[model samples]
Target: MVYIDKEKLKEIYPPNFRLDGDIQKGYINEDGTIEGVFTLDGFEPCTLDGMEGLWNEEKRLFIPNEVAEQGAKSLVGAPILAPTPKIENIREFFEKRYSMLDCYFENDESVYNLSTDEDVLKKYEDSKTSFVFLSIDMVKSTELSLKLPLELNSIFDNLFLNEIASIIRGMGGYVYKSVGDELIAFFEPANLLNKVDDSILCSDYIRVFILDYLNKFLEKNNLPQVGFRTSINYGEVYVKNVGDKLELNGYNLSATIKLQNFAKDNEIILGSNVVNIANKKWKSRMKKLKVNPRKLKKEGLHEGMKVYRLHNLEGRYD
Candidate 1:
């Protein structure tokens, strides 16, 4: 949430400045002459930069813009909503779900089962391609979906997906799939090292963008805030087209999802393979995460294998 100094704004809004300080109207713009300064408590006063008409749907009120999110809402100052399922609960949650997630790890060759539709059968070719996979799971989305009307839920989901996809593409990654409450993307192997770095970097951008920017924007509007977890892994996968969409199957992809499941809200988990290939700066930020050996092997990961998390984030998983 943010506030403006009504007295000060009244001084600025007049014949010199035509618009008022109403954020709901989304009308306010000025160089140095006339401006409505927004202050997020405990942070320095700042302004949202852009032409007028901020309420325009394109402005995306919640999250507003990069300038709006970062300007007044500092990453450290943004109100982080830590709902139910604390760190200990996250550990217990994954431990209990091992049985449910076994299918992803049961087979060494993680090939996608061909779709039954006859028309797209030929598109399911045997060719395999290497990709650095990134998975981001929105936390508590199911609860929000159940509570919100269907159309409203979709609006929120699309808001998230569209913003997230922009971040991924900005880092030169391709969005492979977006399932309910989960976003899966791929970076090509043509430039493996850089792609791995790109995949790892996505988490950082997303962390601040969601927690500091989007969530704050939503909170200001009196809407529910959301959180997410991300995982990155690198490997080869069989790629096929099913109804104009790319479907991928690979052991590493499953491993990515498994790692994401274990991550806490606002957390980024890295598979050992991703760490091995990631640049030194990114690797330096990670603290090894321990997991049950039996469950690790069941997820196509081996005993004594390493999983990593950004050590700076608050969590007991390390």
Candidate 2:
């Protein structure tokens, strides 16, 4: 189990600085605690051994352990282990491969669970937030659905969609909406720098998973490989609650969707705003996507709108 040592953080960072980057993306339970990692300065992000309180997976934010217990008791024996469906293998993968990540999954069926809970929806109710939005969809879903049995297709969809959703949740992003093989997720607004960094990191991790693990699994099973197209953007969006649901309306979201549509399979794209505000080192790693000016639409896009892709994937960065 790990928690944040805020005093150490306060000393290193200024009074105005805040970081809530969740790497382990795990949760602390009533019986025990899960590990997590939070970032801090430069490439030297402070590793979060854990949070001081309960790591609410549904809310994707830390909450008081007392309140967590109350909510857990209210659920009649269901300990609020972030309710993000912590799968054991997923947890093991992070523990072995990425030391900077905090993941708390140890259960199944939690992959598809997301922001529908009251606790999550309440915070964003009738509010405007500046967040990093990421959109992705499987490239081969349509073709697979056409050629394969519905049952087999559904299984494949679930496998691919749930894996990506798990990564989003683990990276401290929220998966509020997933349709078929497509997903729309966002990083929290409290700390945009780490969030943007996390967004790019999340995309790279997904790509690596496709290139390494998923592809191997598909090959072993004699199944075709698949990949996703990802696009990320940043801006303020209004979260309006209607009939106990969240409706996010904004140009950022729309443009992110458009950017995803323009991405090639297995590609990760970033909007201009994200490129402009990203850490300087990361900015150096990205290159603008070339396209016919007439093909790219201006609606819901920034002036001199440009899309970007990571030019360096030769190795993990320091």
Candidate 3:
């Protein structure tokens, strides 16, 4: 996820900017003045300098217009854009232009059985797509969910999904699916070194962002705290959409999820695939770990796959 200084944003756009819908539908004239809306926090929609881009709902930051353009380009998986009118509306522009995959939360009851939904199957023909897969799960979610009222639990889930997914999108990653407490997402693959850099930066930012966001969330709502464990892998996977629903299936996707089992709270696990493509700086932060598949019984992992954990972020931004 792209990290923006909240105080810096307020200085840039002031307190009156507006954030609405999925995108920040407002105004950014040529003079550098911004007049629009912003989602300051996941649930609170407020006005600010209107920039024609997306917003990271949980973190309450508008994506820079340039970054949004980059995200758009990546979403299309194409090299060049034909001359076209500038897109002012985020949802209208993206929905009309890009075929986005679907996301789910853990408690969702939608059956994954392809045979049961023939109509759905017909709508979402599969295609091979390359992306960097990020699979994350909230630690001790069952106990936490049980402690809260169902309505409040729903609020928490919604908050997590909106913020987390928005951060991914802002960083040019697409959320493929979110089931139960597990969220699966991917970044588009590119031959460009900058794109690879962005993917690693996004992962780093997310690791820090979640720790900070959850603390504030729990404190604001008077709820108990929670933790995150993430595993990232990069490769090709079969992606399909049925109606508005999107799903990912393939070995790479499964491998990413399985790798998460070895992670501890507040840790970011990187699969060998992610490590292979990451820059030297990122690679240096990874420490190799050996896994025993016997410990994962039903997790369906092959024996002796290597995974790495990112470490020492405390002084990273210092």
Candidate 4:
């Protein structure tokens, strides 16, 4: 059975970081002490070896075992892990090989089990991964829906699921979640520097492709035009498997959704985290705008809370 060195972990995290819940079978020593337990938050049952710490109950921010030991009040005073690691290649491998629904089912088998099997649940444990979160929403969706007939709505939906989503996947990104006309995607860049570049390339490609191709498809079928806006931020998130499917949720994901509201129609807006890792080449494609510094004070980004608007995808190398 897999086990954690409880004493070592505690020493790193301090008194408040207590282990709760039942210890897994066979991990209890003859002394009746349980040193390790299964996690519902990692890609594999043994992936904690790569993580330095855990998030608190509120899921506000990651608390490194070392910082917790130092009596750090929260992640603000402590140094949280910046970009989450792309620990597994599951999405990148399967997305191109299968349809979105098929890919989701292949990775999230816990949803198919009819019995309450511990092994099945264990097989579905989520992995904590670092990724770039990109949220795309159709601009004036309600108004557009009202104007379109049922056939046109169907056409638009097909364009998103087939065309737009495929473009993202082709660029080594995943359209992990969606609601109505909005899509929430995650891109696992190899390193911090690649996060902004990857997101920019995908977003720019989607924008240009839709403007060029989608319009032609609509014209051929005698339909109206549509526009969209994309917002992106990068950080750690839990890719969890529940009853019917996998879900991506965490502090960073939530923040990205909120950031999406700040984007104007047909524009791609980036958060501070993306801006921080962006190089001169990536930054050149965008124009930086300042946010209300006072509004960002609580999030530890007040010093320079800026968002960048994409100017054009032209001249981008990759």
Q: Write candidate 2's Cα lDDT for 1-318 as tens digits.
A: 333244543564454333322324544444544334333222232223443344434324443333233322322322222222233354366444333111212233534454433455458778887878888888978897998787767667766766776677777787868777888888876655667877887777777776677666667767778888989898888888777577788887888888876677778888887875566656778888776566675444555688888767743321
Question: Mind giving the per-residue lDDT tens digits that candidate 3 earns over 229-305?
Answer: 88887767776765656666788889888888888887888877666555556666889986666764457765656
Candidate 4 lDDT by residue in tens digits, 1-318: 223344555654443322222223424334433334422232122224576544544323444443333321211221212222232342453333233333232454322211222332234358776778888877777887888787666446545545556656666566665677787777765544444566676787777656655555556656677778888888777767777666666877877776766677778888877775565556667787767766555544434657778785663322
Off by over 4 Å in 2: 1-118, 298-303, 315-318
User: Judged by lDDT against the true structure, how good is candidate 2?
Assistant: 0.63
Candidate with the greatest lDDT versus the true structure: 2
After superposition, the stretches of candidate 1 with alpha carbons farther than 4 Å from their true spots are 1-125, 241-245, 298-300, 313-318
lDDT-superior candidate, 2 or 4: 2
Better of 2 and 3 by TM-score: 2
Q: Model 1: per-residue lDDT, tens digit, 1-318?
A: 332343544453332221211122122333212133332222332334643222323222322333343332211221211111122332343333322222322432232221222232234465786777888878899999998888777667766765676567656676766788788877766545556766776667667667766676677657799988899887777867667555677787888888886688778888877765565566669889768888787776767767888756433323
User: Which numbered prediction scores highest in TM-score against the true structure?
Assistant: 2
lDDT (Cα, 0-100) at 51 in candidate 1: 35
Stretches of candidate 4 exceeding 4 Å from the true structure:
1-124, 293-304, 315-318
Go through the candidates in order and give each one's C-alpha lDDT.
0.59, 0.63, 0.57, 0.56
- Candidate 3 lDDT: 0.57
Could you tell me the lDDT of residue 211 within candidate 1? 72
Error of 4 at 229 (Å): 0.3
Rank by TM-score, descending? Answer: 2, 1, 3, 4
Residue 284 alpha-carbon offset, candidate 3, angstroms? 0.9
Worst 10 residues of 1 by lDDT: 77-86
Task: Give Cα distance to truth, residue 229, candidate 2, Å.
Answer: 0.5
